[model samples]
Structure formats: structure tokens, C-alpha cells
Target: MKRYLATSAALALASGSAMASGLDRTGQPIGIIFEEGTYAEFSVATSSVDLSGNDRATTTVGSPGNPFQSATGDVGDRFNMFGAGYKRDINEQLSFAVIFDQPWGVDVNYPVGSSLLLGGTTAVADSNAITALLRYRFNENFSVHGGIRYQEIDGEINLAGGAYASIPGGTYNIRVDKDGAFGWVAGVAYEIPEIALRAALTYSSEITHNFTTFESYTAGGAATTTETKTPQSVNLDFQTGIAADTLLFANVRWAEHSVTDLIPENFGGRDLIDLDDSFTYTLGVGRKFNENWSGSLAVIYADVDGDNLVSPLAPTHGYEAIRLGVQYTQDKMKISAGIRYTRLGDAIAAPGGAVGVANFRDNDAVSFGLKVGYSF
Candidate 1:
């Protein structure tokens, strides 16, 4: 009947969102509330990305001839992500849930022996979020949910090799230790149980964090306090049972990524890491094959509209991804496994005068995920 429960399999495939636009590592979905009865789920995802390019500097101008060769090797790296959540119905008209996810992150490492332009450069960022939500239904068709969220973030970036060579230290290590922030979420939904039809819209508030930014040079280091706000986002999620054993689902998300600018004092208070806004969408269908098996197929798309410069830290632009998953329900436990493949967009590594840069073309990734759930 309600085979769409298998959507969890598809959701697991997206857990590697640490590879999403603008250093977005997690999609932070609220799908757990969709479950009927009491349910708990845990998942792990891993992604391997290949983002590399060749040196395009035919001539030298203003330190543009750094990469040296017209051809180079791979620079993009691999990363892993994890998530878990639980949901339960408090009564006929109320439900509660607690969700854990890694909502944002960055991982980029260039080979130390690669082209001079970007060799020996790396940027790593990590974050985690916990949310508690409550939903109340006044009637059969209308319901609302709200929640409080707590998030923590920390990161380190090493700027070295090419252009950075001219700076006093020849290399700058920027580190931001762990910090926490608070935010909120609210949403409304309409559901019709007979056909398993539901449509919900949610808004996530922005969170601000202040960290002690440490800048290390080859010889000395300096520290300063800085503030940054995580981006605010909106989500529209819809799903419905189409036939005896089939279902359809779609999700639309928009995030104010451009607002999360990481600016440090050493860089004239300018955005050391600036990003553009993002709009991502996913569409999929699920089917139940028998009493114990279900499967899902989905396609993901995103439009990353921005101007990106050449840097080893951020490579590739937007992307197109596909996910396939299956879930096996046995007794009191549900197990799901999924795999995703993404074709990343091509772009000029640097916007201008920067030399030894190449067009990051033909980049792609493969991600695999597994999830387990239990209901009582």
C-alpha cells in the first residue's frame, strides 16, 4: 500500500550532500516526519569526487604562468558523511521528531606534487546539526510543525603554492575552532491519508556563529575574532501514492548561500570564502514489489549561479545527479542501500589574470549509502 516509506533509501543516497553547491555537505531533510507510527533510522554515505584540470597558461602575465604544463592530474578528493533520526506520534493530532545531520562542509585537497599553481593547497570544513520538531494537526487536511535547532562548525584552510607565495609567510593557515549557534524552523502541511498525498513547505532560520580565527604564517601567527551566519533556506516537499504499489515524490530547496561569507581580518575584511545562492530540486518514484521489498529511483538537479575564481579549495560548479535505491523490510527492521552518480559542471578554474589555471571539465562523483530503521 504505502510503499513510499522506501523514500528513506533515496534519501540516504543524498546524505553525501557534503558535495553539494557552495561547500554544502548536507541536504538536512525533514522527511522523517513523514513516517507513520514510531520509527528510527540511521545512515552513512561516502562520495568520491574527481575534479581536476590542465594548465591553460600559454604565456606568463602577472604570475599567471605558475601551473607550467598544459596538462595536469586530479585534484578533487573524497569524503564521507553520516545522519540519523527518530520520529513518533504523540497522539492522534500530534507528532514529535529528533533529527541529526551534518548540514554543511568542505573538503578539497590538491596534490603536493601537482601543477605549481595549486599544488600543496587544501581546505577542510565540518559541521553538525541537531533538531527537535513538533507537529500538530488541527484537522485532517491541515497541520503545522516548528522546531529549535543547534549547530556546530569548525574548519581549517591552507593557502599556499602559486599566488600565495608572494605573501609574507608564503603560506597562510587559517583555522577556526569549534563554535555553536542556534536557529529555528517552521512549516505547514496538508495531507490526505486515503491516497497518501501530502504537500509541505518549510523555512529554516539563519544561525550566526563567532569563532576565534587563527592565521598562521611560516614564521608567526595572529588571531582575531570573527562572525559568520549559516544560510537560511526554504523547502517544498510533496509526495503521493499514484497506484496500487507506486508513488511519486518531489523536493524543491533554495538556500541563501551567498550570505555565508567567511571573511578574515588579514584579507582586508573581504570574503576569504564567498559563495553564490543555490536552488536544487529532486524528483523520484517508488514502488513496492512484494511484502518485504521496495525500491526507488530519483534524479537531482541544481543551478549554481555565481562567479567563481580559480582556487584549489573550490572546484567545479553545478551538477546533475542520479540515485537508485532499494529497501528490504523484514520483521521489525527496515534496511536500505543506495548509490548515486553525479556529473559535475565544467568551468574556468579562475575568472581572470590568475595563471596556470585550466578549465575544470568532466568532473564527476560516485556516492554509496546504507541505512537501517526500526519501528515499534
Candidate 2:
């Protein structure tokens, strides 16, 4: 019950409102439009796990027909997100905006006495992001923007002896602590007056972190130690207007989740895992029914290629989503409400991956917001 509540809170923080263009605009009213604003804050969150091929009991059998049936375990949890930002108009052609939010994070735990407990994998990742941006409006028909970002990340992991009992000798353990780093980004936008079309492309740079930990490589039940570093990642976001009242947005995120293979520093060198890049796409349309009422609907697809390569550590895959929202504007104040539904696709594992890990079926979410606009 506690875990379910946590997952719900996290989803609420990260759920995006329908038809929101950018977080930096708050001027002229269009229709039932949800223009970008600090809204006093924003957030993103998810707390769930995969139990597909993680069965530990029959791991030694390793058969092609049912290699994943060994994992027989379940994972679930709860989390929350919160942040605040502000934007300013520097002039008619230039503007400035700053934002703070959590873009990447994970938290999971495998209890004692579980069959899949080999290597006792337990991990927690917490992070925060701060960004500064500058925008230039060339004319009513076009504009461009770019920025720099700073990220702070930290994590801890402990692998107990029973954790990797599936491996030959059946006894191994390790502990790790990770450090943070910095990153950057740049982007541009173009607008067409005749069709009221607007488009934007933004790129986020990579960030690296150093990790130090202890390893108990009990060959005959012995011990050891070492230090390591995990590489960062890159992300890209693109958005465009299909018509006067429709918008399309998509994002691609690539990361080196393989950094988990390096284990304790004494294992000679880093053993990089091969986690594939992920993608998410969104499409939405807004209609102005008059001056006081407006509404929108959107759909998004998320694909995280962590199937066979994934573990009890963090399970991810393809999913589909739908969203609906309505906005009311009176004078300079706007009220918005929205709802979303997400579904985790079926499982498809590769050779040598965990088995019987639970498939994250579905989730529903709703959001309410108010924005006050003033133009000088």
C-alpha cells in the first residue's frame, strides 16, 4: 500500500499538461491554449519495477526455451517530485528563463530471502537539475534559444553474498558510492505567421560521475576493494505545430546504463553494460471555443529498450499514453485541469536475461494548475 501511494505521488509530479508549448511564455491569449509559465513549479516521476526473467531458482538450468523463468520476484515503490522556475523578457527581441527540475532518477530494492537475490542488488539514485536559457525573437515569424545546465547526482548500492548465488561458487558481494558532474544544451525555434506554425529543437549534453566502493570477491569466500567512474548521457527534444491549433513533440534519450557491469574496483577494469537508447513522442491539439473556454487532447509513446539487458535493478520497455485537458481564462488568470493514462507493453527478453519479472501493466493520472499572466 505504501509503495502504491509513492508511485502515485511521483507520477503526479512529472505528468505533463496537455497543449503546453514551452515553460517561458505568458503573454497574448490564443484560444484554450496552455502557454508556458513557471506555474510556481513543475516535476516528473515514476516508481515501478519489472519481474520478467529474474527467477533465481532455476538460473543454473539456463535453457533457451525458458531462460527468463528463473527470476520469480516482484519490485514496487513510491516517490515525489517538486521544483520552481522564473522567466523574464529582456527586450522585444531577447528573453531569459531559468528552470529547476529532476530529469533522471531511479530507486529499487530486492529483499533478503528472495531466490533472485544473487548479488543482493540494492540501489538508490537521487538527482536535481538547474538550467539557464536565453531566447531571441528575430521577428513574429521566427525565433531561437540556447542554454547551459548544471546537474547534481548521487547514489549508493550494496551487493550481498546471496545476491549472486546463481554464479558458480555462489558467494560474492560489493558496495558502491557515486559522485556527480556537469552538462549543457542548445536549441532554436521558427514560427510562420500565415499558419500560426511554431517549431523548436533542443539538445542536452552528457554528464559523468565517479564511484568508489568495496568488493568481497570471496574466491573461497574472501574480500577485495576498488574505485570506478560511470559515464553520463545525451538527450534531444523536438516540437512543432501541425496547424493553427495542433502541436507535435518528441524526445530521444541515450544513456550508458551499462556502467553497472564494472562492480567493485578490484575486478580489474570496468565491465560496461550495453543499454540501448530510449525514445518518447507526443501529439496534441487545442481548440478555442470562444474567449473564455478551450480544450485539448494528446497521445504519447515511450520506448525504453531494457528488456533482456535489464534486471531487478531497473526494468523498462515500450508503453503508450493518452491525455485530455481543458483551460479557462478570465482576464489575466488561467485555470487548467488534465488527465493521463499509461500502459506498459508486454515483455520480450533476450538470451541470458532475468526471467519472471512482473510486467508493469497500466497507470492513470490527473493534474490541476493555475497561471497568472501580466504584460508590461
Candidate 3:
């Protein structure tokens, strides 16, 4: 049952992408603390996205609205994520784990020298985090875990096109130096080992970053400081054994992204990225075919609430996805592989919170993941 549960989790993690609720990538999982004995694992995932859109006739000025601009030509770029963790049991009742993961990111680039409204616009963001956690078992049925996370983030953005004509040359750029901050995590779990049932609730506090920023435009450039907060989130993970060699699992996650505002002083206090709060739900089933093989399938969904207006830097809203995974175990070594496909909701790119300037539809992405684990 435990092996099946682990396979389900790996499949779900493989499906994670930047298109998730807000800027989520890895889902900040801490399941290593629950592993039996000493365990170690490493995992990696790569995602390729196909996202493009067309400029609206309304974007062009002083002409009949007949000839609209060409397509944006796959603005979404390919990205990869890596994670590793080591867990050790201190005693019968206490355990600790150290984990590393790339938690959040974004990479977008429009073709240069194109007729599209947002041609030549680009944005790249990166983040890395390390977490140390301790878990203590109160009895066979209850346990608690808490941790501290140290994270660093950095990014740069370039805006182009007539939409940004307010700038000196219809272009603007900003680069933010990497910054580091600390946050905390806490969670509790209840389990009934006989039936393989467990429920865990986790809370992750927000981390604030203060970055030294350089802003430039056709008119001038300036060096300034900016502050931004990553969203706080809550996760509920539940699982149970449904029948012999079969398990059921589900998860619910919420992120408060409305408060994660990036308003640089040099940018006239306009929030560069505006995101709404989000909720993500997942359900899956796992089956063990034999002693050494298992497989799982899962579905993920998030609602857009009928709002399609979005930032050009991070376009798209809501999502629906399907994930499939297979695992092999022999002795103390285990290997897992999974794949996911996501359909991104349509969106209208609105710069500076204004009316729509472009439409993005029929976009999607594919992701692949592999994980290796060893227990001693």
C-alpha cells in the first residue's frame, strides 16, 4: 500500500508546471518525512509548452480594422526542474529530512522582428529553495511536522510593441537581482496503518524578497529597490486503501496570489503582474499489478471563474490535465516515470490592466518526469 501511495505522489508531482495555480512548480511536497527507515531520492521533470496568440485589430491605430497582426509564434519556452531529498529516522518516534527543489519560475519569449503586437517581449524568472524538516510521532495514529525554508529568486522582463508606446521607444526593460528570504512550514498527519489511510494538512507561509532593480526605457534608466511577496498556500492530502492492492488519493490546494504584487517604483507604481487567488484539485487511483510493478492515473483541474483578462507576461488561466505513471521496485531500489498533458484555458492579454489587446487560445503543454529512490 505504501509503495502504491508513493507511486501516486510521483505521478502527481510530475504533472506540476508553471501553468499551475499561480507560479507553482513542484507543489512544495514534504512526503519524505513519512518514509520507512532511511530514504533518499532524486527527481527531474521537463516541460514543453505551445502557446501563441494573435494581435487584435483594436491594437492598431489610424486605419481600417481589417488587417490584424500575425501570430505570436510560440512565446512559451521549455523549462526543467530538479529535486532531491534525504530522510533519516532519529528514533522510533522522531525523524528528519532535508529537501531541495526549484519551486517557482517563468520563461516567455516572443519572436523578434515580428508584426505581432508583443513581438520581442521576453520575461525570465527563476527560484531555488532548500527545506529542513523534523517530524515527531505521538503514537501510531498521529504525527506532526514543521520546517524552515530558505529561498532565492530573480528575474528580468522586456516589454515591446505599440501597446507600450507610452515609453520613449515603445519598449521597456527591468532586471531584478537575486534575493533570498526565509519562511516556515507546519503540518499534521493522522494515519491508520492497518487500512493504509492517512490525512495530512500543511500550511506554507509567504516569503518576502527585496531586490535591487535596474529599469531602462528609450527615455532613461534608473536603479531602484523593489519588494515582492510569494503567495502563502495550504494543502490537504488524503489517501486510503480501497481494496486489495488498490489505493485512492486526492489533494486540494489553495494559493493567495492576489497579494503577490510586483510594483517597481520606477514603473509608476503599476503592478507588473496581476494574478487572482487560485484553487487546484486532484484525484487519482493506484493499482499494484505484482510484487515489483505498480501504476497510477490522475486528473487535475482548476477553475478560471469566467475571468479571461491576464498579464501578457504570464498569460493563460485555469487548466485541466491528465497524468499517468508507472513504478518498479526491487529490493531497496525503486524507480518511477510519469507523463502529463495539460490544456490551458483561453485568455486575453491586457497590458497595464487595460482592455484586451490579444487573444490566446488552443494552447497546451506536455511534461515528463523521472525519479529514483533508495531505502536503507
User: Using Cα atoms with residue i matched to residue i, what is each candidate's TM-score against the true structure?
Assistant: 0.92, 0.67, 0.96
Best by TM-score: 3
Candidates sorted by lDDT, best first: 3, 1, 2
lDDT of 1 by residue, 1-376 (tens): 5435445334444335536777776666787876778999888989888887765554331444444464346766677888899999999999999999988887877677665655667788888999999999999889999999999999998876554556676677889999999999999999887787889999999899999899888778789887898889998988888888788888888999877877877755546566668898989888888878888888889888765453446776778998888888888788888888889877666522244255687889888888888888
How many residue pairs clash in all the candidates, one count each? 5, 30, 0
**Which pairs clash (backbone N, Cα, C closer than 3 Å) in model 1?**
17-25, 18-25, 64-355, 310-349, 310-350
Candidate no. 2 TM-score: 0.67
Please provide, for model 2 over 1-376, each residue's C-alpha lDDT reduced to its tens digit, 9 standing for 90 to 100. 2111111112222344311111100101111111232223333323333332344333344543544533423433344444545566666777777767655444545555453433255566555677777777888656666677776655554444333444445543454444556666666666554544445555555555555555555563323333333333443433344544444444444444344344444443424122444455556555545566656666766556555344444544545667665655565444444555545454432212534333333322233333232222
RMSD of each: 2.6, 8.6, 1.5
Q: lDDT per model, in order?
A: 0.77, 0.44, 0.84
**Any runs in candidate 1 off by more than 4 Å, and if so which?**
3-18, 58-72, 308-311, 351-356
Best by lDDT: 3
Q: Which residues of candidate 2, in runs, are more than 4 Å off?
A: 1-73, 113-120, 160-163, 166-178, 193-195, 212-264, 267-274, 288-294, 304-307, 326-337, 347-376
lDDT of 2: 0.44
Q: Of models 1 and 3, which has the larger TM-score?
A: 3
